[model samples]
Target: MTKVSTVTIGALALTASALAQTSIAQAQSTEHNTAEKDYRVFEKTFGATKGKRRNHTKGFCFVGEFAPVDNAILAYSNSPIFSSTSEVNGRVSHKGGKNLSPDDKFGDRGLAFEITTPDGDYHIINVNTEDFFPASKPADFIDLVRALGEGGEAVKALAAGRPELQAYLAHHKKNRDTTLRPYEGTQFNSVNAFYLVNESGDRTAIRWSMVPSGSQGIVVETNSDFLMDNMNANLTNGTVSWDMVVTIANDNDDPNNAAIRWEGEHTRITATRLTVTSTSTEADGECDAVNFDPTVLSDGFVVTDDPILEARSQIYAHGIGVRLSEKE
Candidate 1:
């Protein structure tokens, strides 16, 4: 009788453990599904631009220098990324898969840069908007992308019940007309939040923005390669610049949900300045050799729990894999 009881109890325990493992596997599968679906949908919607970045394929590389504002940023983090100064390998691109995307149209723009320091390299990519797409999760963003295939107006439907989406669309809609071209009044936002650990190990949640130094320039619709032309012309005259403004999040802020912008007044710090001195028309420039993966950070910089940010690292890895294979 005692032997029979022991055998039965052991069987029940094994079954329970199997059930727990199955639950964990299911959760992980869901996360992967969201990320994989995002990549597949992007391919379906935008098509493939072989040997180029899956998105933001249309861009010109440039070399520049970045330095923290007189070592003022050290109070927040001692990361080498914000140390004295670093060489910048940056790319300015239209936010789309079309390699020949024109500059005259109203679309999202991107500025991705790799900062090479003495210790290591760090990267940052920001969109030319105040906040990112108001998608709470990877799945929600994929749905928006699929909806986008239907048309721009169709995307508005997703905003109907969600005030957050509505406000986001409303903000962009108003800003679209006055939208600054790549080097103009464009203020590139980090969108996702990150935690910065100082020497003492105190963590501060923040989002950074690259704001053009001068007043917002007026929009001038020009030819397809006009923006690049303008950048070259501007460089001939003088270097372009932007202020690195970091916004500190309050305790009530949600570092996990980028879909919702942090509302109300908050502390803003001018971390540093970026100066672009030279432009490159070459397809295979310094920026191409390196993947500007934002998650790839130096010490003192830590990623947040934002699911969209996490998904980006995976999605970008898939992108680089396909591009590198094309080269081979």
Candidate 2:
């Protein structure tokens, strides 16, 4: 009886060991698959555009400063950008193919800005849109780009059959008010998930928006240079300010999904006040050489596990390399 019991116990232990090994192997396999998928998507998308300038090809650059609101810095991120003032370099651009002029009214608009803080430089690249397209995964984004590249025919073909593409298109609406109003009044969104680490080492997933301090200014004229002219005129008069408001994530939130806007009340703290004071049209402007990668973050802030964010860093790095090679 004792011998039979010992044999049974050994068999059970062996089975448990085998199961643990299988679990580890499966986890590793999944990780490997994800890495490969990201690599393939990066190559397929950005590789074709190598040597050409980035999609938001043309930009009007500016110089400014990000000043932290003293009372608003509690319980949120400990990043220096929110605790101290920092010099900033920024650009406002029309989104489309490279060489598209600021006057192009057909494409999306973007704000790419960098803050040089004591800890490190933090880059914030936002768009006028509230949500990102192909909002969930790297492959989804690759497909969306490919479909759009093929034009209306491809979109129509996929729109009926592909729910993923359909969902993306439904959420991806350009801000029509952007061109009609002064750029200062236009709200810019992070679009991607990011984490704000507090002093206790606790991390809170959040998305932020930059809202202009004043009411939206009406655009009297419709021209290509109108956006630029308004910005310059405002800067000459005084610094234009934006309030940084963050929406904290709840348990129901999906950090990996960029398409789903955070639902619920937002914590509207004035974390940092961004003030743009001057315009720079110089070929050697500070922002001209910078990649303005959103993944380039400072301490106390981190990008979430969203595949699109990971893939963006890789693509932007590749684009920068290609651009530099062309210059050389």
Candidate 3:
């Protein structure tokens, strides 16, 4: 076995502390920007046209309840939903700016769920993947989007020579590729990290995911409405459920890194069961009227210092506004 040096360990610890401080500072600065200005970067980068919505614009809505598991692992945070079951309104969507049908295989897939608590509504927006791409910092994310929008040539150049782009691609290729899995088999992750603080002020860095109970091999290509049809058929039989699990961070884990997957020794505890009991077309669903901001969290769960979390909230609000404007 290789001998580890105390100096190296100390350096690593210092680096981690610095990163945490930087993340906190960035989050504070980003939160102060006007919503419109914050969103303009996302719109220009991911939207098909200026002042429009994102690429994966179409979605199906659902009504459900999130039931706490009897043996659920208790964290420090005391979010209301954890104490009792709460009604939920949610949506599953294709990730893009264009109004593509559910069956379209062009972009990533996403899920946005809102839980109604006595204090207020709590939202969790996730994509059908274990990790997020590019970088967790808002500035890096914006740069990555710009590079992607520049097309194949720019991407090729970056892959061949750019250090930042090369590192990002190397780290994220696996998770990004896995985003194409069928919805039934997909695992939706709360990409941003958060703090679970208890009444006594003890805090734990955590992230959560809604994962399918079992693997159902890859799905074959079908019609433009295949995903919707599949969901409808499943609902006809009964409610569909997913395991809601929270992954607690290890001592050495970097809470702000969205690109890393906390695995192996990291403890994952079952928090609840998310059951989708009913479905509705987008036009008839509550999703159209609700803004699913991930930052709209509950009291016990505090937003982490991660800047990406704030960026997501701003972009989501922009997407909602754009969607509403289209209807007018």
Candidate 4:
């Protein structure tokens, strides 16, 4: 074909592609979007970064152990994990889609642990905040991310309409101010609720938090990966640990809305102590092969009615497949 004819054909192809893209975007329904939609939005916002989890892209894995603080937890959940110390894969990360993301940003922080128990493997991916994402449902969360990505007035407008989102952002900002080093006593919460099934076939609605032994404020800020720096240094000296404190939901508490924090005083129990003895880079660690699938619960805990909690499995699956398959 002549150069002019080839150029004309390429231009037409580009126009068709643009139209198709617009059509796809316009065809989407905001209210009824599914896990697949959430995955697509995530991929579009960030990318299929090689060898990294699509979200919580930046991480450090640590081989550790999770031991129950005491057998008092057995009253709530009669699982073997609560009865004996078990091996664990602990991962800490800055919540985002970019690998090697700087630790200086005021983003949500993630702390995940995969505990291999005698019964089965149990995974819990918690966050630094006391509450979950601003969006309650899966689709709304996708919308929140899209709006935040747009920045400027879009964030303001969305938060203005949703009080929960406003409260979440406010809490995130407050924690970001107080949180310094990752392993230096940074508190992480399992914002989603779960039901702890006891031996009597009774289930207790509960939420858990990893309260650090101690916390450090920012001593000095520089263009450095101080998050991991502090974590590694802490590990070299000795093991770092957190007390997993589970909070019971009151009779009036609403477990349906994961986004809403249960107000008023409640019963809290120190269930497990997770100790990190060693660390490795995300790509070089055993955690790279493990998906910290939060939905995978043993006989101890059953899934809650929270829509966001129900939605995590598929989103996580999509992420692991994409990141691991992408050529380095």
Candidate 5:
């Protein structure tokens, strides 16, 4: 009797283990399928631009006429992407011995988008260089607007439109500001920013500002620990957010010109809570310390104090070699 009981118990345990393994496998398969779908969707929507620069991640923006409703913009993105400008003031401003015509030169720094629905009017402002607000060509803009109006089928169809999305999904690269060097506004307001600096030491700046959906601009704080804690939570919890970007055209007014176009925004994080980290290795141990600006080491073992460099070092040293455990 005792022998029979032991055999039966072992059989049950084995069955349970098999079932658990199957469940895990099924879950992984489901995730893979979902990722594939997202990939295909992304590629179809963004299209193929030969020289298109990647947006924050890999999205583009456009101009379109949309109506306000409880489900307008959200509904629009579900459908398609298709897609600016401004005013002047009285202060006499002059630069380079040129009398500045404020009306023609200075307009509202951002574009205002209005969508009216039964609930009320929804207004969204897009800062030119903001990652969240990507712009698209004129014709694409109209298609996106039409898709939103059509709804349901239009949205789903748009989602399934791309082939390159698979490549994006395969890489699974997280989009972070990877601008080289420190400029006026690299870190600011709990968000990341960047600007393109030419050999002449002049830069075209762009800032990435993130705030809750219903909230105004990013709440600049003076504490790093507090801000980091909140940011992680906000992102994990899916708190609605938007990015503010500013683009600058240096010595040029025409939008079609690429050489003059650059990202420009000032002040990344307020000075109070800013901290920069870099890696250095001595014969004895590895050290990570705060830095004022970027620094690089080609010999012995030291790393540039820039965030991009830090990320790369961590990846190469810890991730590739399995030298350290992953940390949040």
Candidate 6:
């Protein structure tokens, strides 16, 4: 029960009194109809790809959020392959072995999000990785929520000079049954919770997110061999964690897409008020992918493989945003 109720947002609430107070059998576990029509359109259709054995080895994941927003901003769909129309069974990078086509390979990393106080700096809207990543992993998730909004102590010194986030939290804390499986036909990786008011404004913080659930996101499988022969099955009980409503503009000069028109109208980001968990420790299967140790993200940011080929030649393809802390 983590704060979801834009009147329950269901039936993909494009609106109908919010689809009559939402509830098409829990509307894909609600969160403003699964965080904008199924979590960021299903991880911009599978984080643009780089799985299933790509010798570059590792690095490819992202998720973002920050609350109490005013110049609120959030925009995803960086376009690496949203439509040439099909094939994304592992997100991308066949390399020279040839045979790529999640719309002809993808992963050229380029991520941007901004919000610097002092009365200026407001440009937080990115997602364009239709495909590109000759070699990737330069600290994703929008560089860890702008490094916790640049606070003091800087996220425990970026968890002590990253070694790929300390070897991905010590290889998922003693092998979490080998994590990694939220990027294959998405479903239930929706959590973008952040609330900050630090800088000595009398304390208040929060951050957490999940967007590594690819393939146009929200896939949830369980045809049920009786729920996988009862292998401790819970399959997201009473799920729903959405509410990504942002609005904060200073005009990036809208020539129809550079977009910036806050004050209301055409502003959208809603998984419809949410916060629900029935005990699940973030991780899916066959783990490892959080990479951020270029000496703790080399001050102000530095992740290359050429932004994964510039996040697949930019425009916003591998669209992911998440800033978790909420409580330093």
Scored by TM-score, the top model is: 1
lDDT of 2 at 43: 48
lDDT string for model 6 (167-238, tens) is 444543563332222222112210111122222332111111223221222234433111111111222332
Candidate number with the higher TM-score (3 or 6): 3
Give the lDDT ranking, best first: 1, 4, 3, 2, 5, 6
lDDT value, residue 272 of candidate 6: 20
How does each model score on lDDT?
Answer: 0.71, 0.64, 0.64, 0.70, 0.25, 0.24
Candidate 5 lDDT over 217-310, as tens digits, reads 2233423122223333333444322322223324433333111223443233211111111111211111110111112111111221224323
Highest lDDT against the true fold, candidate: 1
Q: Who is ahead in TM-score, 1 or 6?
A: 1
Residue-pair clashes, model 5: 34
Which of candidates 1 and 5 reaches a greater TM-score?
1
Lowest summed lDDT window (length 10), candidate 3: 2-11
lDDT for 83 (candidate 6): 11
Report residue 62 deviation for candidate 6 (angstroms).
20
Better of 1 and 2 by lDDT: 1
lDDT of 6 at 212: 26
Candidate 5 residues lying further than 4 Å off, grouped into runs, are: 1-136, 163-201, 210-268, 271-328
RMSD of each: 12.5, 14.7, 12.7, 10.9, 25.0, 20.5
Candidate 3 ranges with C-alpha deviation above 4 Å: 1-38, 48-52, 70-72, 101-107, 118-121, 159-168, 171-181, 214-221
Clashing pairs in 4: none
| Alpha-carbon deviation at 75 in model 6, angstroms | 27
Per-residue lDDT of candidate 4, residues 1-328 (tens digit): 3122111112233343453343345436542246557777776776657556777787887888888886778998987778888877768877778887887755667888777775545545445545665778776787787876677589889888888888988876775555345545577888888899999989899888888863334443434477766766666666678888889999988777788888889988888888877788865676665656677776778888888876786666545544544432
Model 6: weakest 10-residue lDDT segment is: 319-328
Cα miss at 314, model 3 (Å)? 2.5
Instruction: Give the winner by TM-score: 2 or 4.
Output: 4
